[model samples]
Target: METSGYTTQIRDGLFDPSPRDSIFRVKAAVADELAALDDTARIRSTDFFNHTFAPDFVLTWPDKAERHVFLRMSYDLNALVEDVALIDSHDPFIFGLTPNEGTEKDSRIDGAVEESGAMFAEPDALERLIDRKKTDSTANMLSNAIAQGGRGTFIGNEAVEFASVVSRGFEAASDVKAAGTAEAISEIEERLGGPQAWRMNRVLQAVWEGSEGPLMLFPGKADLSGRLNIESLRYLVTYMRTDDPEFWKRVGRGLKMADLEHLDFAASRPNIERLIKANLDILSARAMVLVDDPLGVGEIDRESKFSWDIRERRLTFEAPGFFAFIGATKKDLESVRKTTANPVAVSTFVDRAEKAELAEVTLHSGSEVFILKHEDGAIDTHRLVGVSGQFDGPSEVTQAIATSSSGRVTVDLTAMSGTGQTRSKIRLADLLVTATPLLRDLPYEDTEALNHYLAYEVDHGGVTLDVPDDEESLVDDGVAGGAEPDDEDE
Candidate 1:
């Protein structure tokens, strides 16, 4: 007969007929042979076998200081003899002991017994393992969803329902089948949509299903506090309104609110406005813009100049004598020129402006106010009187002024104490350093820095001041009092 491995036979009448005596003699003989292989080995009857009443012996010993290994051998006689041979030689029958070589039956019994022992050792081990596996599978699903652009792919509760199905399918399967089921579930989950995807999908549905687009569902202020992939939302709107793959890619990379300021939303204006209102809290000034004009009226007027305060989210149109302490770039200045009527003035401002972090811009009917914070914490306020239409470039400042306490130095270029004062020509460059000594060390020529600084200031506050034709004052009254006026007219 075929056996797993080596086998040995013993004469049937070698021991007493009594089962207990016979078993003892058989074990004693086996122990002698086992000792030759490992002196420390011990033999025990596991009472597990392939056939009824047949027992299996386990030989276990320490292989290393703290590690143990075992071998199993089964004792059987009927399995070894043919049917005809067994009938003829029933009296002089031979018994055989065959070593078990990790067969399917032996493995299953070992696994069951080991698991039972483990349950006694740690009651929550299996549960913890299963939980960990589930968590890992979920993480993999999310990763795949993100990598495959699975955003907005699912409907409400669909992802959860699919996950439940996968779980149930796994549970109904056998151990071997369960492994295959789990793998298939992982692949399927990767393709299925997730929570964020479902949210996007819902938004898309709302936009397409209603006449007012997303505004029909979220009219006043939509709250999208935790959503990070705003690009997808932008893509949806942009795709519906226009087909610009390059712009879409840029949106995908992530566009600032300022970037979208120039983009024409067309039919998707309501959707874009909804998105903007929903994320106002998280939108920085550099990434956002506030327009005073009506939506879808006409092309943006490139000649109208405006100043933006980042912290206050204020925008001032055609404001004169406003200072932008925030950073700006040539590119940003060019973008501003396109929206303003006075490109020459913007170009001029671009040539002279410097980047600063702690300045405020306010427009007064007859005066311009500038608040300057010095290195020594001293605040100097400078007011420019009767400087109308003098500095009309796109001015953007950082948000530092809005969030800062009153301790901040503010330069209000509003109408000064003297309304009908004689105006003297003063160079804009001289006014900046004279108002704030800190500006002397800063690079005023870097337009890039100015663009960055403008982003912050415009978000805070942008004040518009009307210049009265009567107050043509050009003299630096406050910090620039001692400086002599240049011969050239400003």
Candidate 2:
């Protein structure tokens, strides 16, 4: 009922008695209708059906002439009264009473909760909706009641409004268009709160499943760009891990993203390993290990084979490659950070024979290692190693190779090098042995071509990389210049 020119807000889809005796009187008036049933039409629970988008019932009659009676009451007077005959013998009428039923001429409140987005599909789908909805709510009171077979309603218009909003969201999600980025789905999440947000997540997961193209979230991050091929799957996985506890365990077990198999296994190794740790289904583990870019951990004793004990929450793989090992190290570090524990126990081993000069260097949390390997040929360039915990800033460690008789390698951590130089040399050797593949792509070319370009740009600070507006191309290939190009500017 209207209070002080406004409707009092109901809490948890249940009637909240106002301090004024007026609303309490309204509740008492509705309760009086239960006396007509004589206990034959039992109310298992007093459901605020309108709060959940369902019609309200006033009373139910048993052996009497009128089997069901609906009271539409306003604060001042009773609205239209309905006395309907029970057509079905199995049907038992439930009561739902709203405060403003009689005052307004809206007879369209005949719709039920089954007509709303809460029950967008049939019974099975409806049950799923309730379960998911329950999980989304911070208070489990409503969900607990719902799970305990408490189903029915007391209000109408409010229920209709709630249903309409949810229905629109469901319809929007059902469109099944793949949002190109994670931020788009985040915006969707902001728009669809609570139960609808979960549905939206499901819709995104479905869209990702059906799509054939790669979806990139956080596309600007060069490493995370082409690597994250499985559209909104990451968002869903993250959501389940951080927000909804039940869905991740129940529904996430059946989750599969075939596109994960197509990700650049070597480049996305870290991400794939993290995903495995977070989700850890057989499909994910197999995708991580059996993909085209294999971990390259050669066969060992049968005991050394990869194993995942889901029940125990333990994962083990013996003699994994540098990529897999680094990935595991990162995951272990994450777990440690979460619980504020020391992560020194997670270790990687290298055979001493292979790592003669530098062996048994543990790359754990708070550790840094940089390597500079010199190229033997005309390139005269070096490779900078990118270790997980290393390279916090510009690397101080640099190595120079002299192409003389012995082909000696000297480590330089600035000209005044003693202890720093020694440490650099050892770390460089360890890095070379452990992370050769990552280092290969990042060759540091300290050639004259680059030097000359840098010098010219420094001398004329206004120089921009883009070609001048008058010029046809950045480089003067044959097509842009005359056949016999003069040295002097034309």
Candidate 3:
């Protein structure tokens, strides 16, 4: 399984393959286990056992109510394996795998599709581990695999050695006992808070120049500050294990990859968008930022009310926003840039938007000639399903709103109409909007992305986006100084 001598030189490429075929072979074994789930063809004994308990504690089903209920996950690994194996056969130099110079302005693909020999990923190890959770009880099995990876000889031992180095660092960390383990994780996170810290922590090259195997732990970005996370070490060791007790919990626990110390920041319960994103076979890890946040259109008539529909391929969505369709895939995100690039249609949003300037009402629900005021405020008297509209008492005619593209107000004229006469009145209310910056490409701006820009003051041509005053995170930047803080010496 030694890969040190066969693959690309570590100083050279970030995306390189392992010299050992065993790694993929082991992964292929894992794939077989997951594929077993779909093997309904396999006959099993009628007898079943019951031992289900959830740390989150929710009744998932009638019989299995007390146990932690897992959502199903499935993918065409047959295709994935083909793609992975394909990456091994060719070098970018020979096959044009590296990113072209022109692609610099464009976003990087979540998975490298077209390459110029620059970057290559061999079935990401972390992704392979997470993918196991889709099958029944594979989380526990994968945990066992990861746990064994470290202690056992062969490839597993290599995994162990890496974990050992991380553990040694964690224990030796000065912040260990003083702040408590969890808090220490927080402190280490604070230390690695900036995007650059993460980039620095990455393994510079995927394949090393010479090694018995890929150099497991080259201190390219080891934290000497003695505040690194214990789980960082533990994750390295047990990430591949499904039977590791915490495997399912880790995957099932939280959907969002919050900031380092965000373990303390509680999630505001899961919503529709989150549920789909977490449970889908292919999660769109791509984060999107909002150029202009959309709002809801007031409830109106059938002809005037807004409506939206979801596309077949799309699965992820950001709510109470613009667009008609509701879901998307990774490829769809790609076409946005590849396409004309003007007003890129991301996925199939319902295009159901409410423009304050375009507010209008065609159907009057109840011959109630109430003043339908515009911009003053609006309400949903009948309650829209996929449409948004409004009616005021003192106003006459007003503009219109695009609820689907903008907000989540719904209307079902089919349900609430009388002889071609509209009959509902909804008063308008000021938007109760919560402004959260939309995250998109370049979201994970690790040091690699901002090469040579570490702690460079923004005033002196440092890498800084013109973030809105209200939207930018002081917590993220670690420079809480307000309004206009000097970027010079503290």
Candidate 4:
């Protein structure tokens, strides 16, 4: 029975859409017949069986052109099965529906079809050809589907193309000879709008088990040399593994956008910390330079162990020889001026110093003793004496005194011994400067004297010393011996 373009035949029940009249039953019959053929014969003619005839016959049996092409393919497949030698001589059938062919026979197809036929004729080549054909077909199907779904915009078009290339590359990742995957990935990255678009596409984001997944979405080192914004960086940090050294190496090649001062540090802190831990030098340096404070100067704890100099608008963290200064300007408290240090560096330094057993100070005022490093590297403990008001002296001298009072003091006893015994009285500023390294290691105190001094300095620009002039009187008399004076100032 002939219906429309399809020719219904009853030969061994094959190609017969019978009582059921289902195209699926006809395909099953054809599949069974193909299965019964010799493995070599079937494998050699897989392209013919799988593509040229079967799909068209099953998919478009009602179309006259497809039906006519299917009949021709069916005749060829049967003839080749019977003769076997015919498979080596006959040219493979080409699907005319392919847009690239455009009704003209593709010259490129002839050599490939001839080569496939020759390979099929060889017993040893059948298995390799079958494997390769399967891989190629799978990759082609993925590419074709991506190509067909264009949104008509330039970015949309490139995005579709990017997805196609990525899909094909991943599909062939398992093939040992597929060294072109990396090259293909590079080619697609050049055409892509940006890395952010990678995760936006469901096809690109689909993770392949035991594969790199969207890792190839990252721009190559040469491409990443340009600046990336916080959002782009956030995308990379979110998807890329911290443990992957290669990911960091690539990230290190890129420059971050200059205006990250406005970045949401709180939301991005975890990612930034992860990058810092991964040894991302660029981000590390940037973190040390940009200051982000959600809380402005008013909320700053002036008397905290970590010194906040209201006059200088600086918060200092001191550990032995290391000091990190971070603060905001009056103009913008959330972000420090370009000249000021980054607040992020404050926490980073704290974490590092604590991990290294270098320094840890409480922010609140407490009875923690001051740590004094002597000239011999031996640490001496001293009970911190409560002193009131800022030291009155030169601006530079008072600044030095404020620094010393803020944290632990390192004194060089060897340097102070010469001038100490002879002098009954010394300038308070001079004594603080000469005896101590001027280190800010202690928490800030809200003492009436210090507050008054800070207030006077802020208003009048300087304060005068009110303490006793006697040098011996400066030391806490409660200690067994007088204060071991240090000469070498830090």
In terms of lDDT, the best-performing candidate is 1
lDDT of 1 by residue, 1-490 (tens): 2311112222231345887665555555444433332233355554433232333444443322111111122322233222213222111101123323332222232232231111010111112222333443332223222222222122223334444554343332222233434443443434333443443333323322221223234322233432224444533553332233322222222223443444335434544543433323223221011122325223242222222222222221111223232211111221231122211221232222222333323322223322222343322222212232344533321111211221122222111111111232221122222222221122444333433322311113222211212221233221122222223222
Which residues of candidate 3, in runs, are more than 4 Å off? 1-158, 164-312, 316-361, 364-373, 380-490
Q: Which TM-score value belongs to model 1?
A: 0.22
Rank list by lDDT: 1, 4, 2, 3
- Return the lDDT, model 4, position 263: 36
Candidate 3 clash figure, as a count: 85
Q: Is candidate 2 or candidate 4 better by lDDT?
A: 4
What TM-score fits each model? 0.22, 0.22, 0.22, 0.26
lDDT of 2 at 368: 47
Q: Between prediction 2 and prediction 4, which has the larger TM-score?
A: 4
Worst 10 residues of 1 by lDDT: 117-126
Candidate 1 local distance difference test against the native: 0.28
Off by over 4 Å in 2: 1-110, 114-195, 198-304, 307-374, 377-490
lDDT of 2 by residue, 1-490 (tens): 3321112222111354444454444444433323221222332223332222233333332212122222222222121112212112112233333343354433333333222211111122123333344334311212221221222332423323333343343233334333333443453343333343443445344433223223342111112222233433433332221333222222232333333433343333333434433333222211011111134443342232232111112232222321221111112212211111121211111111122222112222334443333233321121222343254443322212222111121211121110111111121112222232111121123122212211211112221211112232212311110222112222
Model 3, residue 139: what's the lDDT?
38
Tens-place lDDT per residue, model 3, 1-490, is: 2223112222122232553443333323323332331221122211111111111111121112121111111122243223433433222201111122331322332133233121222222223333444542323323332321111111113222333333333332322222232232332233222332242132111111111112234333344422223333222222222233222222322222111112211221122222222222212121111221145332221122222122233321222333222111112222221111121111111122221122223232235432222343442322221232343322211112212111222221111110100111110110101011101122233212222211121112221211213212222221111211123212
